[model samples]
Target: MFRRIKITLSLLLTLSLLLIYLPQSLPIAGAAAAGQASQIDAVLVVDVSNSMNTSDTDKIGNEAMKMFIDMLSTKGDKVGIVAYTDKVQREKALLEIQSPSDKEDLKKFIDGLDRGPYTDTAVGITEAMKVLQHGADPNHEPMIVLLADGNNDFAKNSGRTQSQSDKEMAQAVQEAKDAGIPIYTIGLNADGKLNKQALEDLANETGGKSFSTNTADDLPQILSEIFASHLKLKVVPIQSMTGNGKFQEVTINVPNASVLEANISIMSSKPVETVLVDPTGTEVAVPSDNVLLSKSKSYSLIKLLTPAEGDWKLKVKGASKDKIDINLVFNYDLELAIDPIPSKTYKTGDKIDIRASLTSNGQQLPNTELYTNMNAVLVVKDLDSSKTEEIKLTNTGDSFEGSYTIADKHEYELTVRAEEKSFYRETEPVTVSAKGTTSSSGSAGVTTPKPADVEKEDAKPFPVMLTIIWGLIIATLLGAAILIMKMIQKANKGFVGQLVIEIRDENTNEKTFPQYKKLGAFKGKFNLHQLLQLAPELKETEGFIFIPGSNDRIIIRSQNGGTLEKSGRAVDISKGLELKSGDRITVPLSQADKTIFLEYLV
Candidate 1:
């Protein structure tokens, strides 16, 4: 019995030691999975000409615009509106959507849109660009969506002539292209009088899409497509329903946690009601903290914020004869990255292979059904001629691969764009120089210099004296850099002013006088032993160190057994807490005994 008791105690001792020495690891999985979402700034340039009054007698365009506004997430996305005829008629500066109230206000503004006498497409485009230029976010992706009949109508005595207006329009489009802002054009061809070619030119020149429809009723669908394309998302079609005045249930998968938002749009001839059931079989209430429901005359939209990863059930109710079409657009926080190019230069006619992949939480996404429907393309641009070309890529299980042939000797910029039925991503542009047979000036033929001229250029003597002079200059600069580095190192070894400290007892409410000590007197680290000399009453403090940090700040590092606080909030001092001037820190000297109060006086 004695031997067995001793063995049991030894095992417990070993376990205690292991616990004391084990490293503490934080739970970091999925903590950085969904990073910050990129913001979007969009401008709606609408043509409210007299022709629109006839082409859209019911003002369906207004309803479409309102739907587009409702689709925007309350995630700091900005929007502007420009209604124009021969000149700017009404304008709304860029407004950020922070809540449901902001979207309602914007829709109300769209409701008051009135028709004007004539249409000058140039005026509409320019005023929209002006609104963006005045109040655009530098970090946001900016775009302009123009809705027009594409007619160039100017009343007599209007300040601008047709030729001048055309010139201004061309210049404005070029400016937008230079600023990397795409102009999406929606042409209403209800009367078959739409200037189709004009609208296409505007979109094609600025890397945007041109959409047209013959019936005004199609305006809402077109608007939804434009909104999705502009934000690199896709319009996923759900089941179409023939309502029977009873609630019908449909199941939709939320897919993955990378999705930042899921906007489900229900388009119908009349307003339909909806109810949502989450994956856990819990009924989700509309207008709650995580769900937003927007209803209009022709549509009802439900936006789910950071939806759970699983299947979701949605119930819909409408009139007996109503037709309801449902669709979903998912906004993801995943990033697509292209592998680095093997070389920075290539010969003409060489085939360059590109590979790209998707990542969330900085980890590559595995091969799954998500890549089966994805489309990848390589966009090549000539640096000198400003020409662009797209090459399609195939999905190779978990990655995308494609090859492009270099046809000229000029420098080219390359970007890989990968898109799925739900979201799209593009990489930053990379440059590569191609050298061979083609002329840089884009001429039909290449011209080669004569052998005699090449020999003459090669025969020139090397400048030894100039080389030596440059070598000495570089040496001098390197010495100066080394000297400056040493000075900076020396300056960081000490800090100004002393640390003032006080001790207080929690059980007895006893206090101690203030004690001051120069932090520079201790080299490298200030341990508890050094501090105990200044105030012997603070003997309870152990395993604490103070190090001089940059900018007159002191770093406080603590071990186990006490709590550190700043202004009544617990401070995590396991790593270090930077205490600046005028900041006060308190650490309990024991579990239920005295406390140490510290402040830096500079």
Candidate 2:
């Protein structure tokens, strides 16, 4: 009878668990789109302490800063500069690069940079992050480039000790990591007395690369490499030219139609003149319809936009003693995507299968030769412990694949990066949780306890009263489980997920945080006016409405006298428009001088 009671209790507990977790097990309709950036936002943080007067007397660092700015796309990439000693001496807010004039403005700022008396690496990084925090766009990728020659050397009057500076630096780095920003560091070891480990730690802790140089003259090449790597591009070497005051021709192959821009960089002590000819043997004029030319004392950059796919000829001329080095950095509109996971639930010891591929122009990369020299790796980070692990992946002709066993009972972020000798690309991060060894957290499935052995003497006849109580308990749990299953089905059909929103006051140059609005609880129309409390200026426009649609989509409608847009194209929502996950909707309030951006996510 004791054994019978134990079995009855076990059955009751099992039914209770089913009632509690049934709703959570319901399948979500679709996955959210990967958070890929449409453009880039970068900050250059330079150390200008008195020690730099010995290391970078030639100020090649300034020229490198100019070259890096010149390489940004003219289609809205933004950049800022910060020069620091014990504190921030000079700074510029992020400025969008929309034309040649914008590039010149940033270069002019770089030219005005000078040295200060003390050094404080933490101050430089902190100020750079502050600049990005105020101006960075949610749709853009953000990064920081830091150059330092020595360690922290605070003045007595600065009121900052090494320990205090270190603490602030740690907090700043954590904030950058949380925001998905990487800080690339460059250490100048001109005197062989640089703090290499400090710079390397800053980079490694935030998913970035660290570079060291013995001479400031190498700054330009390192900067170029950093710019290319940050944008997932390849800087292909063309050839080294020995000048004889005559034009020499070189053939450049635009491998495929996917190439968006081919930036040809020529580096030498003196300027090298260049002429271009198309694949059809027709001479293309310099600085013409689609070509842009930028020249400095150390280098010349010729940018070709949407060039034809074939071998093109470039002619270069320089003085007899000039030794010019040429490199081609091709920027393509490509995406690295990770295939969907089979299970929505993850747990410690679970083996996850990761597969990723490259795509361009809405098509998978077709050439298998492109994968010959490529390598891929999986990066996983534990947000709770701040620990990271990397797993190497194998190339499978057309895609990359690997497997990773979850090792901890914590939330982990997974990202895959594929690279070759000259270029690398990474997918946006995906998050998963591993709830191991059922604990009090109630995050994992229930563990059943075995019934203990019962002595024959103790196994007496069961009481009739106990039997009735046991029967009632079983009936109650079973009924609850059935109701939970029904609720799960209803919720699945009504779910529309949520929207992540941000608002900007263009006139005042003020912005709001990225916040979420829940829509899953609404069955019909969701009014945009409901969010006015978060952004009071939103009250200026007629409210927007969203209703449920078929096949995991929402229908959007605008009220009278309101303007709506998608990707800069006006949306005629009078008849209602269907939008799926990953769609961004824009509403402009001319009266209030503000704009609201909404992104749908599941």
Candidate 3:
């Protein structure tokens, strides 16, 4: 058979060189286990005072919060809305629910909320903890959802009485339980002037939960059981077994949807013996009845409601040698993106093209190996000389392209990362437009000093001993006339010479380019990247003026705190500021772009 066709063509040439030298840094276990994600920041403290305007309970609290924002899951929650009375407004800010036109414009902005007159309920839980600490997404995991129908009355219409508004609503319920943030209240007690024990102490003081409706058809099953007890979707992972007492199993599969709410948890630093086996084999403690059993000093939570979708078994039985951990959450929806949307103006050598697209519960999902499964990075910042630039983005298939350059006029601050699974940073300052160079060689320790020129040391040739140089120049001109008369009596009112910076335009004084830099000597250290390479137009800056004691011109505009020492050491002028000769500083950039300078070391 011709030697069996030369052993099948040498085994197909060793499987074509192992698929062409495979090794794109291997390990991609299903795109890194499908990029695990489960963030969550939900906030919604409605009330609309005037006592829920005589009970439609604000239209049943806007149809149970638009059916709990249409069962949220744009890859694990993100929502906001405040609407209080007796103060606190913030209508919408923490967004990220990526589509369905953002839950239909947040249910038409919660049906055009309007009813304020008085009812503080602790200023709507401190403005939903200040919109989850200023518009969520800083590692998510904050929740509020309150709905109140009265209580904490704005003390006699804003005067402070009712035991000082129930002791500041129990100190805003212990600052949302010391920021482990959980509220979930909701009580519209149909006209009986709701309050229901301050909404059950703001949902039992934090571990959330406390619902009441009284009419409007029980507000959609109590806001769908408070969003099915704070939705989660899927997390599964905690499979282990070794010594310390036997039986350890995990099988979980669950998915044939219709309100799952499965759960599992176990912890140990010492006592363990968890057993949860269901899937038609019996033995359970939370298989329904919307169960809930919590514990904390280490962990032990159980909350199954209708969990049965096949292969579910979990058992752990330990006693000593520490090791018993299992945690599985389920609510569902995670995502990822990077698409063709990178323009607001890009032209100092452009080559952008960053792609983004992949939806988890909304389902678009095929990234087709967006760069052998992820790792990109392309930050760029200038924000008037804080100058940063981190680039890596290379993948060009499912999208990511690179090419960058900026010469001047920049306020850019773009970010795009993936690794820790898709993150997107933003700061709002993307201008970019300085190609023919007016400034900005792209930072890495910026430098632009070859033109503030000053080179004049060439007129010296008279050394012919004229009578022993006229008696050593008459005793060196009498010690230079007593050090120029003590430096002109300590130059008490300006005029020494050599520190000239002057970049105007503090709102049309218009000058920023009459370039003058003679900062030759103030005696070292004016750091701060040499004052941003000597006035690359300083803006929105922080302060500094420490030649402090030796001259006493200490300025302080820290807006928060100040400390920028000098002659007694401790310098890091945060990019520069220390003037003398009638100093007249003003820095303030970004949308009013001002710099107003005057420093004169003379």
Candidate 4:
């Protein structure tokens, strides 16, 4: 009985050892529980721009917030909130709880947010940093998740320009980087016109990831994946190529885990030779070596050398068979090229004839069949209307010509794309101006008026013309009455003639007289000839004349003889001279002297 009991005890001990040592095949109870221990601290910065006031933005925000809260709650971690507009209005403390709480506070904050007219992202980041600095402990990893629909337009003070705001915001980001904070940015727009580049830079600098979202509905799933599988993947070497004009052997190494299988394949713009080998140094079936591996395996070697130089892709499928997880790496080599082909520009209802010659490195390619596989798009946009038209090209060997007629005047840009194998070259831009046709009237050959002349003719002339006629009539009546009264008194008024004089003042340089035209009376319009007569001293070289009420003297010169036509217009000259009791008028002479042109009727 003692011998039998000893054998039975040894068998039980052996069974317990098998359960403890071989955990992979055994039913492990706490394997998932071990994974839950590692948690991360996440901060979400959301944009509440006026443009994001739609139901889509609200739904995405709510769903993403719910997922984040759920994940963090499960991990017993803390999550913070920052609701931003043109300014950061509401912020919540990082809530750390042992049990999941209803997201009432977060929902309330989101509901109360008022969509702002503008965005000031710099201020929002500063506010977020304050919350993060206070909430994050030294032991936990801190990450910032930024969501924005627009660029940074935060101003230091009122009246700041866009460029000034950009500079301030860039400095603020640099400050955050210095404080050891990592930022993960998400662009919610497809075109990425906003602060996308800035957000990407923030992510790269802070050792965080950047993601782009095309549709708002994809946000929840993407965020969930981010939280669930937050593993950091670092590519070793990052680049590898086959040598010796053929693909013969290739190798890849993954640290921290043994590689179970690796399958390699090559793709190029042009066909070339290829060969592949497995990890066990065994040759696999090379059914058309150009295509390479097609199965899931532990190790693979690819050998390929391409003839064309454009873009090439090498796909590497690797699996950690020991862990039952697979990983993939894609290697890309893109070549650069230059091709000269004159693209065509066309208007609607007009036909386009396109002719092109393709050459590379100063050598013309062989007589290859020209494929007219091109797509043409026409976008017409104005203040009140917009329309778009898409046209597909038909294959025409060597050369292609087509016509399109346009109905209205517009500015258009045409793009032509040519592809051969993996090589593609886009032609330079072509602009087409399409305007409605004009009909000729009579034999005048389409008389089109100059824009400037048309504008001048359109100006109103009623006010100016009436004023001139009235002033001329009044001046004529007054001059006739004064002359008749003076003649009756036998006043010795001087005859009309050119009188030249030079006058100077203490302060400024002399200026030339401007031409003024005079009509029939003092109230009549003064022409250029009258202006010369009034300042005859201007006729002499370097001589100047000063009118009574004017501030500056005017220089005058004569091109022909000093004689010039004078108007019969008259004016009172009593204020500008020290007249004698019998003097009616005084005139300035060429000798820097004053002469009486008319005697006063005493």
Query: Which candidate number maximizes TM-score?
Result: 1
Off by over 4 Å in 3: 1-38, 44-122, 133-135, 138-144, 157-185, 188-191, 195-224, 228-253, 256-261, 264-274, 278-293, 296-300, 303-329, 334-602
Scanning candidate 4 in windows of ten residues, the lowest lDDT window is 516-525
The global C-alpha lDDT for each of the candidates, from Candidate 1 onward, is: 0.79, 0.79, 0.56, 0.43
TM-scores for all predictions: 0.62, 0.61, 0.27, 0.32
Preferred candidate (lDDT higher): 3 or 4: 3
In Å, residue 434's CA in model 4 sits off its true spot by 72
Worst ten in a row by lDDT for model 3: 420-429
User: Which residue pairs in candidate 1 collide?
Assistant: none
Which pairs in model 2 have colliding backbones? none
The digit string of per-residue lDDT tens for model 2 on 268-311 reads 88877888999999999998988888888888888899888889
* Better-scoring candidate (TM-score), 1 or 4: 1
Q: Give one digit per residue, the lDDT tens place, for model 1 in 216-285.
A: 7787788888888877778888898999999998887787777888989888887788889999999999
- Model 1: lDDT to the true structure: 0.79
Q: Which ten residues in a row have the lowest lDDT in candidate 1?
A: 529-538
